[model samples]
Target: MNNKQQIEKMTDMMSKFIALVSYKLPDDVENKLKELSDEETNPLAKTIYNTMEENQNLAQELKRPSCQDTGVLQFFIKCGQNFPLIGQLEKILRDSVYQSTLDTPLRHNSVETFDEYNTGKNIGKGTPSIFWEIEEESDKVEIYTYMAGGGCSLPGAATVLMPGEGYETVVKFVLDRMTSYGINACPPLLVGVGVGTSVETAALNSKLALMRSVESKSENENAAKMEKLLEDGINAIGLGPQGLKGAKSVMGVNVVNTARHPSTIGVAVNTGCWSHRRGKITFDSDLNYEINTHKGVKL
Candidate 1:
């Protein structure tokens, strides 16, 4: 496709894809919820899981968002340097969010930081936040679309610790936060932990961690071990489904880490409630596309 045609196709495709994300949980998430519900022994938690299933059914049937918040849009893009629309990708995504907001009828959750006013179209400053990665040798682009609801990603916390405080402190910090606020995030949660050199790096890492599949494990053996330990620790809290109590408190815990300054250790936590509205899609130079997170989706 030519440059102009590529841009228009991309914008239209993404608007529909993101709108689909509002109502549908990705395949991995849906499967994880089913697994947790099936294994859950608590009657109340089981019932809550059933209700969540019913809610998904109704959302699909009615063609509306499953959760009321719908969340502010966030896009993580990995684009080829040679992609025809690379320069225009940002505008295309911004326009996509605007179009999706109208077509999906998303809730107006964006407010200016200091001005403190809702942007009715979900198009306020920095709304539909985009983070980019450029590939040098190809012409394909991959995008991950996420909805950060107030109860989930918005209220998350982060901190930096002294080197003397140790990695153990990171464990303690995450556990303490989950114990104190995880329930409020509307469990069972997809917990994302970021460990890096500073609070900002850690914070962004935590978000990128959430973009991975619940079943994924870190390639770093130590990090993978930490993921298991954290997962077990969080689940042992018994916050369960909707925090009503059950066998599992989270779908899974994902840890994304980076080299840190010797004197400092940074950690941040972000959560995705059971109805995590995240989706992944890829497009080739020709604008032919595929949805990676949701199976058999035409868009």
Candidate 2:
């Protein structure tokens, strides 16, 4: 195929992939939910988990979205410097979002700010946000597609803390948010915590954390320990399934940290609700593709 045809084909593939992710939970998330359901003792929590499983099955079987709020699409891209389609990547992704809106019939979630008008197509000024990271000496591109649903994204927060406050403050911040507003996002959340020198950087890191597998751990020993501690502390809250109170408040806790300014500690929180619609796909120079987050599925 010529370059034009290649771009069209890739865009179509991505559109289908987006639709696929909207309906199907990633493998890791599905497994985690199953484990939680089996381990849950509360009758209400058990019923809720069972219903969630039913929802997943029906969505797939009927070829429909799992949730009514199809969410705002976000793409986190890691592109290799030598990838053949590097030049066309941005346009391809934008086109894919537009096509997915029509093909998947995604909920009209994007609205024009200040103007107070819905875009209807899920595409508007700066809608369908894309973030990029260029990798060195590689020939493959990895893209993380996430659906940031309204309720879950509402709890996102970031702030700069006094250096003296320390990591303890970070823990307190997350706990406060979870206790106060987490239920609005739905319970058994996968909490992503980001620590950096500034609020924006930390916020981005927190969102990135949500894309990680629920079973994954940070490389840094301290961060890994914090993850475990936070997970334990949150689960102690007993928010359970649908926040009706149960054995666990969260599915997992993930921490992503970076070197911070000596005077400030920036921390942020992002939560992914139980449905957690996200997927990872990679493409080589030849445009050969692999789906890492979902298995036994074709785009």
Candidate 3:
């Protein structure tokens, strides 16, 4: 296809992809939730799980969004340096989101800051937030799109710890945030923790960590251990689904850590509610696409 034709195709594909993700959970997340439901002994927790399952089913069968808050659009992209559409990728995404708002009737979440008016297009200054990672020696672009609702994004916090506070302090910070705000997020939550040299980097990493599957583990051993410990600690809080009080509180916790300056330890925490509406898509240099978000389905 010519460049213009390719762009149009991509835009159309992304609109459909956004609609699909609004209603469905990723395959891995769906399975994990089912597993957790089977393992839970609390009656209320079990009921919540059953209800969630039914909600998903109704959404799929009836072709409706699972949650009323379809959420603000966010995309994490790993683009190949050699990709033909690299230069236009950002514009393509913004346009796709704008088109999707009309096509899927996605909630109008983006608004101008001082103007205080809905963009209606879901595409405005910094709307449909997109983060990019350029990779060498790759011919395809991989994108993870997420809907970060107000509730789930509430617990997101970032602060720089004094050097003396140490890495353990990071754990404590996350645990504290989870205990205090995890309930509001509709557990079991997927917790994302980022550790770096500065608050901004940590905060960004925390948001990026949300893109990882709940079943995935950190690469560093210490980080991995901390992930397990935090998961245990958060689950013990008994926030349950919709914070009603129950057994486990989080689906899983994934920590992404980077080298830090000697003076400070930066820590940030971001969470995803049980619905966790996110999707993954891969496109070749030619812009041919495959979406791997949901299971047993083709588009």
Candidate 1 lDDT score at position 284: 89
lDDT of 3 at 270: 97
Every candidate's lDDT: 0.92, 0.93, 0.89
Strongest candidate by TM-score: 2
Strongest candidate by lDDT: 2
lDDT by residue for model 2 (101-177), tens = 99887899999999999988888888789999999999899999999999999889999999999999999999999
Q: Which stretches of candidate 3 lie over 4 Å from their true place?
A: none
What is the Cα-based lDDT of residue 54 in candidate 1?
99
Order candidates by lDDT, high to low.
Answer: 2, 1, 3
Q: Clashes in candidate 1: how many? A: 0
- The predicted structure with the larger TM-score, 1 or 2, is 2
Measured on C-alpha atoms, candidate 2 has an lDDT of 0.93
Q: How far in Å is the alpha carbon of 57 misplaced in model 2?
A: 0.4
TM-score of each: 0.97, 0.98, 0.97
The list of candidate 2 runs beyond 4 A from truth reads: none
- Residue-level error in angstroms, candidate 1, position 82: 0.6
**2 against 3, candidate with superior lDDT:** 2
Model 2 vs. true fold: TM = 0.98
